[model samples]
Structures are given as structure tokens and as C-alpha cells.
Target: MVTIEYIVDLVNKHNVWRGKECINLVASENVMSPLAKRLYVSDFMHRYNEHFEKSHYQGTKYCMEIEGFVKRIFGERFNTDKVEPRPLSGGQANLIVLAALTSPGDTIISVGLTSGAHVSHTKFGVVGVLRLEEKVAVNNEDLTIDVDATARLIREKNPKVIILGRSLVLFPEPIKELREEIGWDIPILYDVAHVFGLIYAGKFQEPFEDGADIITTSTHKTFPGPQGGMIIAKKDFPDKLWEKIYYTTFPGLVYNHHIHRLPALVVTALEMNAYGEEYATQIIKNAKKLAEELYDRGLKVLCADRGFTETHQILVDVRDYGGGAKVAEILEDNNIIVTKVALPWDTPKDATENPSGIRIGVQEMTRYGMKEEHMVTLAEFFDRILNRRENVRREVTVFRKNFQKVHYCFNNI
Candidate 1:
């Protein structure tokens, strides 16, 4: 007896429960601004626009204008004139870039899942889909890519492309060092999906100046835009490479490009231009504060020697408390959301069933105006739930109620 009303009720329930009651700590998610959310649902959603240039469909002049404006804003913000805001997700962006940069059977180097690489970077996902060979880069003691080892591997293997960036990124990658080792002839693509907001706000390293030939990211995550993907390249990158990317994105991949999200993405880009620095600074501070407080509370927070994190994420080894999956479930039951994650030492099997780690991101909470003190309180919640075996769901709901309003955007609109 399924009906439209039942579906609507389910949607409403989620909107209230997840939106209003829980403290979201998912690293790969974010809340759009009120204005951005409103603009996200528009006439464009019902229409279609094909190709990057003039659309093949009629009544798309305004869509064309918004797309161009979005591209221009990203270009100005990132200090590059070549920007593509069309891919549907970060995974798709990676796919487009890979299709453009390498052929089937070509070898590419990227971080492995155990070392915090996203699945899209591995043989299990798009790399496999494209029939490319994925070679994992070595990791140091602190879970960062081992620059010297990676350089040696590049020399020995002669990979078609080197991909940098991580899902559990804590410190900035050695993009400059790796580039120096490999020389300027090789292409290095940095997938900044996880740290997009931090980079946009200048709180994280600038990949382009650090020798990344191309940068790809999803517009959501820390960027706080509606769900979509974007790619930007250095102005001096080979024109042929750019052409390959363009063609792969259009005829080779997407057909419509989801025009409705353009306006909201533009609004988010503008908001970042206005309030990005302050917001990014707060997010990093909150992540550090939360990590420190969790460590002080006797939790095994990762990279304490490196000040917890330079970006919005924090990782903790939760295996001591019945493993990551169990701990994540317990935390979610208490209205604290986090994802079970594989640490550097985890095997492929452990990464799926019972990982040894939990990943937390403070960007969304920071966007909701949570400060260092709030981070301290949040860490206390984790302590109560994990260490003391307390049910703090009611308390967490009350605490989250005060943070429902989104910050760092033009709220008055």
C-alpha cells in the first residue's frame, strides 16, 4: 500500500530527524545556505542544457549565462581561467580527468584506500571502469604519502599520471616536492574534494601554485554548494589536455549537466568569496580543538604530534572500543554521526566490515557556527558515549537544536 503520502511522510521525517535532531559529522557532506537551497529548486530543474557552449536546447540562454558566470567566479577565485563546473560528482570529475589524461591499460599512481585514498582513485572504481592500472603510492608513518618513495616509484614505473590528495587528509601533500622530483613534464592532478572549502577559503595549501597541473573536486563536501563536481586547470597546462577533458566531459560522459544547481553553486562560490577565510579558519580551529579535547579525554585521536589536523577532518583509532563499525553505530544511536574509516594498517577486508578508525569532519558544524568551546562540548559527548557508555541522544538533540541555522552565507536573502 505504498502511496505518495507515504513517500512524502518519509521525506518529512528525514528532514526533521536528520536535519534538526542529529549532529552531523560526515566528512563528505554539507548543508547549503538558506538562499542557496531556495535557489536550488528552480525552473532550470525541469529544463535541459547540452554542451558547454550555446545549448543545443532552446530557452537555455539564462542557463548559459549562469553556467558562464559560475565558471568565471571559480576561475577568479582559484586564479585560473580554465574551469569546468559540469561533472555530476567528484567521482565523475575524476572519471573525466582520467579519460582525458590516460588511455586504457595506462598506469597511474594514487594513494591507496588503506592510506586514505577515495575509492574513485583505486582499481575498484572509475580506474577499473576505464581499464586503467592503479599503482598505490607509499605512505609514511603519519599516513601521508611518502614523497621520496612516491618519487622513486614514479621514476621506476613511469606512470602516465600522478594523482595527489586523500579522503582522510590531515597534512598537506608534498605536491611541490613530488613535482620537483618528477619534473614539469608529468601531469599531477590533485583531487581536492574533501578539502575544497578549506582551499577556497585559503586555509589549506594552494595546489595550483604547488605544481598541481589540474584540480578536481565536488562542489559539496566542505565547499557547501549543492551536490556537483568541478575541474580547474593551470592556465599553462597543455591545450590538448584541456581539449580532451572538454570532450570527455560532454559527448563522452554527461548529457544534461544538471543545470538547476548552477545558480546555487554560483551563490555558494560568491559566499565563499565573501566569508570563506573566516569560515575556513574557524573550521580548522574547531577540528583541532575537537581532536585535542578528544585526545585529552583519552581517545586515540590520530596525528596528535601534528596538531590533530590542518583541515576540517579528524581521525581516531576506535578499534580499542569494539572497532569502528560498532563505535560508529553507537555514536549514531546517540545522535552523533561519523563514518567508519580504514586506517593505514587496515587490510582491504577490514576497510569494509570492521575498520579500525572513525573519521569526523568539523566543517559542517563550523558552518553551523560551532566554535572551539562547542568543539569541547562535542568531544565531551563522544567521551560520554564511548568511554562512559552513556546514552546522550536527548542531550545531543537539544545541543544540535541551537545550531540549526547555517552561517557563512548571505542569510538575509
Candidate 2:
């Protein structure tokens, strides 16, 4: 029953269904550009660039050049001299940072998972694995950290480091306010996993200027690069710590470091430098438009008083429509892809299944050349599905057919 032909057919079938038909709205996903994906299949994928202080492998002249150039250019792009281009994913980058900085049983303040923090920032993930105690910053009603209270808590707790940024981020974190209270002693690591492209475009908040000393980011969410991660800091980041992070990334964590993604990362950074402003602005516009349109059609789009959102994502309280579990499945059945997430008030029972919200992101669709008007049509699709209980799978497929080209990049430009 199992054969190479069968495996190839499965891949082709998946491409046609997910790539050509479905309206992908996954918050943490993005497509590589035609150019980026082309280079992603390079010979470097077959090689290794394992190094610490110095490389352990040879025949890597081109690999050394590409990796070194990536480190230098991304350093310049983020206005920093320190960059660690290892860590296979965002979660791994977080681990490296914690390992280099915190010893076992140290305390780190993080945003609570129910309040939108990524799992790695919680005790349930890397913090617990490292034997670190994790305390959470107070979350305000709209899911932002309560600044003044968090400042007081930080002083009381005297945490070794505090982590900010969230998987469900809407507004920018109150980094400047927190910094004003806590001052420059403790390091604030802002995980820009979901918003790196926005910040890179200068569309979102500035990390260093806003008092964040470091950033750990996934390069593929809004960033449109190969799946990888980086740990970055300011120009004058403490040298000893930087050296530790470098070694920790090389021998301490990964060896090959997936040298293949480096080329695609460089290409994405170039494209982002050229057109990221337009791309980021469109993503936010599409999110807000989709939210307002969905709200008008009677869906409970959260944070309406705050103009829906400042980033690429919007959350809907879908408990009225058989909860987030059934709602997400129904949407998927109709070829409208999204993820269910826990709201601030979700019960522990609700958190795992039938949570209160469905998160929609416009970044992936924006990359595929969808715009504000298309968001209106998307809202109508949601209205028909959740409000009227109708199936729109065929219409969704036909709608997707018009927007296959990756936009705001050098694809066919």
C-alpha cells in the first residue's frame, strides 16, 4: 500500500488543496516568496556549518560567507552589532537566552498564557525545563500588561529578567512605562515572534528605544522567511553575555543550524527593507477592516473600543456559535482556515477545548495579494458560516483562485 508514488501524490494533493484553494488565516504562518523559496532549495541544505569560537567543519567557504553576511546585515538592520543567527525556532531562541542568562531556580516574569504569552515564556514550557520560577505580569482587560502594577510587581519580585510580547498580541507592550519604573538593571526580552516584520518595517514599536534590551524572534511569521530564529541585542550589549550566547547557540544548542535557511533569510530581509512598510500597513488595515466588517455582521469581534487591533491579528469571541472548537472546525470544513485560542476569561476546561475565541490573521492572505476589499468578502463568508450556518467552500476556493501571487516583494517585480 505504501510507495514513493503514493507519498508524492499526497504532497501534490496537499499543495492543490491548501495552496491553491484554502484561504489560509493561520496567525503564525506565512509563505516564502517565489524568489526566497527558489533559493531555499539550495545546495547548502546538504552541508553543515557547526562552529563555536571556530568552525568544526570544512568545505564551507560559501556557507561561512552566507552565514557571516546574514549575521552582519541583520545586525545593521536591527541597529545592533550583536546577533545570534542560530536557534532553529523562536522557542529555541528563548531557551538559549534563558540558559545563557539565568541559572536554575532563578525567577523570570512573563505574561500569563491565558493573557496571550507564548508557551516558552510560561512555566509550562522552557522556564520549567530550566528549573526557573516564572511569575506573570498583571494583564489588563484588553489583554495588555497592566504597566503600573507590573512595575510594582517587578520591584517586589526582583526577577532576573522579564519577558514581554505575546502570541495573541494586539497593542504594543508598555515597555517604556515598565522601563521608567524598573530602570536599566534588569533585561527585558521582547519576543517579537509574531511582529518582527512590522517592527522591521518601522511600522510597530521600537524595541531598544522603548527600553527593551533584547529581542528573540521567529523569522517566518510575518517575516516571510524560512523557518528559523534569531536573538538580537543593542550595539553595546554586554560583550561577555554576547559571547556566552554565541557559544550557547553553536555547540550548546544546534550544530548544523540549518545553514539552508540563511540564504532565504537574507533574501527576505532585503525584500522587507525594500517594501515592508507597505506590506505591514496593508496587513493592519486588512485586520481592522475585517474586524469592523465582522462586527457589523454581528460577530463579537473583541477590543472594538480600541479600534480592534494595532497588529495583524483580531480575535472573535465565538462562544455563541457553538464555542471556538466547533466554530474553527466548521470554518475549516468550508476551507476558511484559522486557529482557536483562549481568551483572558477562559476556564481551564475551555482553554484546552471550546475556548472563547477564534484568532484571524491577515498577514498570510496579505502576502498572497489579498487586500481590504477582499477582507469585506471574507467577513461576508464568516457571516454566512457562523451567523447563517451555510457552507461556502466552493465560493471560498473560487475566491482564492484570484490571489495566488505573493505581493509586496520582488516576485515578478
Clashes of each: 0, 0
C-alpha RMSD by candidate, in order: 0.8, 1.0
lDDT of 1 by residue, 100-209 (tens): 89999999998987888889898998888989999999888687888888899989989898888989989899998888888987799999999999998888899999
Instruction: Provide the overall lDDT of each model, using Cα atoms, as 2-decimal numbers.
Output: 0.92, 0.91
Q: Encode model 2's per-residue lDDT on 322-355: one tens digit a residue.
A: 8888999999999999999999999888899789
In model 2, which residue pairs have backbone atoms overlapping below 3 Å?
none
Worst 10 residues of 2 by lDDT: 47-56
- C-alpha lDDT (0 to 100) for residue 81 of candidate 2: 80
Q: Identify the runs in model 1 with alpha carbons over 4 angstroms from their true place.
A: none
